[model samples]
Target: MLLPFFQEDLVEAGCDEAGRGCLAGPVFAAAVILPKDFYHPLLNDSKQITEEQRNELRPVIEQRSLAFAVAQLDHKQIDKLNILKASFKAMHLAVKKLQAQPGLLLIDGNRFSPFKRVPHKCIVGGDGKYASIAAASVLAKTYRDDFMKELHNKYPRYNWAQNKGYATKEHQAALDKYGPCRYHRKTFRLDYSQPRLVTMTPSVNSLSLNSEVAVSAE
Candidate 1:
C-alpha cells in the first residue's frame, strides 16, 4: 500500500542504501523512478521481505521502472568518509547513473547529502511508505547481497555468503582467529586482543573487487 509518487506531476526517484551497518563489504544504494501506475502487492521495504521475495521482486521492479540504477561505496571509501557520508555518496552515485533526471528525490532516511540541484524529501521509513523507495531498497539489498556472496568465494573462512558480512558471532569468531581481511572495514572495532591476529594485512591481489571505486547495477 505504498504511495505511487510524492507528487503526481513530477518525475520522482526514490533512494535507499544497504549494508551501512555491516563490518565488511560495500554499502549499496539504488535510485528508482517508477511510472505513476506502478503497483505490486508484494512490494514493500526490503527488510520486510524474505530472500526469495526480494529476488523475485528485483526483476519485476527493474522491468517495470522507468529508470533504475544501483551503486555501491566499498569498504575503503567507507573508512575514508565514515559510514554516513559514504552512504550518502553511494546514493548520489546511484542517482547520477539514472537515465532520466528526477524532479524530486524521495530518500528513505531522515538525513541525506543533497544531490546536485535536485530537491529531496527525507522520510524516516519511506521504504515502507513509498513505491519507488521500496523498489530502491530491494535493488540495493539484493545487489549488495550478491556482491557479498562473490566475496565469500574468495574468503570462505569469513562465511560472508551466510552472514553477508554482518558482525555475526561466526564472523567475529573468524576475525578473532585470522584477523581482518582486505574486505573488512578497518575502522570497525573488531575487539581482538591477540596482536598476531591484528598483524595480517591483505595483499595487493586480495583487494580484488573494485567495489570501493564504483559498482553499478545496469
Candidate 2:
C-alpha cells in the first residue's frame, strides 16, 4: 500500500514526469494534491499498470484530488535545455498551475529542480511508494500518450500511436525512409551513421521547424 503523505499536517503535492526518454513528443509532468485520506488499492506507478488502468485512474484521481495540474515542455524546449532540465521545467509549470499551493513536494525521481519556495523530498521510486505520486504518474503518462496519439494522426508513417514517440526499431526504420518531420527532436540521435537528415530548402525547413510543436492539456 502507498503512503498518503510524506509530512503530516502539510499540504503535499506529488510530482512526476513522463516521456523524458522518448525520441519525439514533449515531456509531460503532473502535480497532484490528493486528500489526506486518499487511498486506492489499484494505485501504483504508471509503468506497472495497464493502459486501461491508467485511463480509469486518471478520472478518479482528478475527481478526488484537491488540486491537480498537468503541463508539458515541447521537443524544442527539450533540445534547448536537455531532457533532464526540460522534465524539471514541465513539473515546475504543472506546480505553478495548481489551485492549492503545496507546503511540500513529493517528487518521484531521485533529483528535482527546486520549485519556487516549496520544499521537496526526492524519492527514487516514490510513484510506487506514495499515493499522490502514483496519481501524478498516471496523469502524466496518460496525457502524454494521448498527445502522441494525436500527433500520430498527422504523421502515420512514424507509427507514433503504437510506439508513443519512443526510439523503437520501427520508428528508426521510418526515419530512414521518410527522414524526420518537424515533430522529431533535432537534438536526439535519430540516425547513428548519418547523424543528420538531408537539409531541406529554406521554405520547407521553416515549415518543418514550425511543425515541431507542443500540446498542453491540463
Candidate 3:
C-alpha cells in the first residue's frame, strides 16, 4: 500500500540508511527513483520483512528503478562524524551518484542535512509509506549485510554473518571474549557491564570513552 510518489509532478528520489545499531561494520544508505508504475506486493519497510524477502526485492528494484545508488560510511568515518551525520552523509553520497537528478527527496527520517539544491520531505516512517523509500531500504540493508558477511569470513568468532554486527547476546559474548576488532565502531558505547550477559565483564570500558548501550535508529 505504499504510495508511488510524494509529488507526482516532480522527480523524486527516496532516501534511507541502515546498520546504525550494529556494534561493528559500516553504515549504508540508498537512494532510489522508481518509475511511475512501480509496484510490488512485498515492497514495504525493511524492518518488517525477512532477509529472504529483502534479497528477493533487491535485484528487482535495481533493474526496474529509473535510477538507484547505494553508499556507505565506514566505522572510522562514523566515529569521526558521529553516526547521525555519517548516515546523512551516506544518503547524500548515494543521491549524488544517481543518474537522474531528483527535484524532491523523500527522506525516511525526521531530520536530514540538506543536499545541494534539492529540497526534501522528511517523514518519520516514510519507508513504509512510500515505494521508492522502501526500495532504498531494501538496497541499503542488503548491501550492508553483504559487507558484514564478508567481514565475518575474516573474524568468524564475532559471527558477523549471523548477528550482522548487532549487539545481540551472542555478539556481546564474542566481544566479552575477543574484544572489539577494527570493524567495531570505536565511538559506540559497548559497555560490557550491561546485564545483557550474566558472564559479561567490563571489557569495553577501556576501549570506549562511553559505556552505555548504543541503540541504533536503523
Best by TM-score: 1
Pairs that collide, model 3:
none
TM-score of each: 0.91, 0.88, 0.87
- TM-score of candidate 1 against the unseen true structure: 0.91
Runs with alpha carbons beyond 4 Å of true place in candidate 3: 193-218
Cα lDDT for residue 128, candidate 2:
95
Candidate number with the higher TM-score (1 or 3): 1
lDDT of 1: 0.87
Overall lDDT per candidate, in order of appearance: 0.87, 0.84, 0.84
Steric collisions counted per model: 0, 0, 0
**Could you give candidate 2's per-residue lDDT for residues 117-161 as a string of tens digits?**
999999999999999999999999998898888777767888999
Q: Residue 44, candidate 1: how far off, in angstroms?
A: 0.9
TM-score of 3: 0.87
Tens digits of per-residue lDDT, candidate 1, 1-218, equal 89998888778999999999899988999999998999998999999989999999999999888899888888889999999999999899889988889999999989998999999999999999999999999999998898888777778888999999999999989888887777788798875544353434433233335554443333
Show model 1 residue runs off by greater than 4 Å.
194-208, 212-218
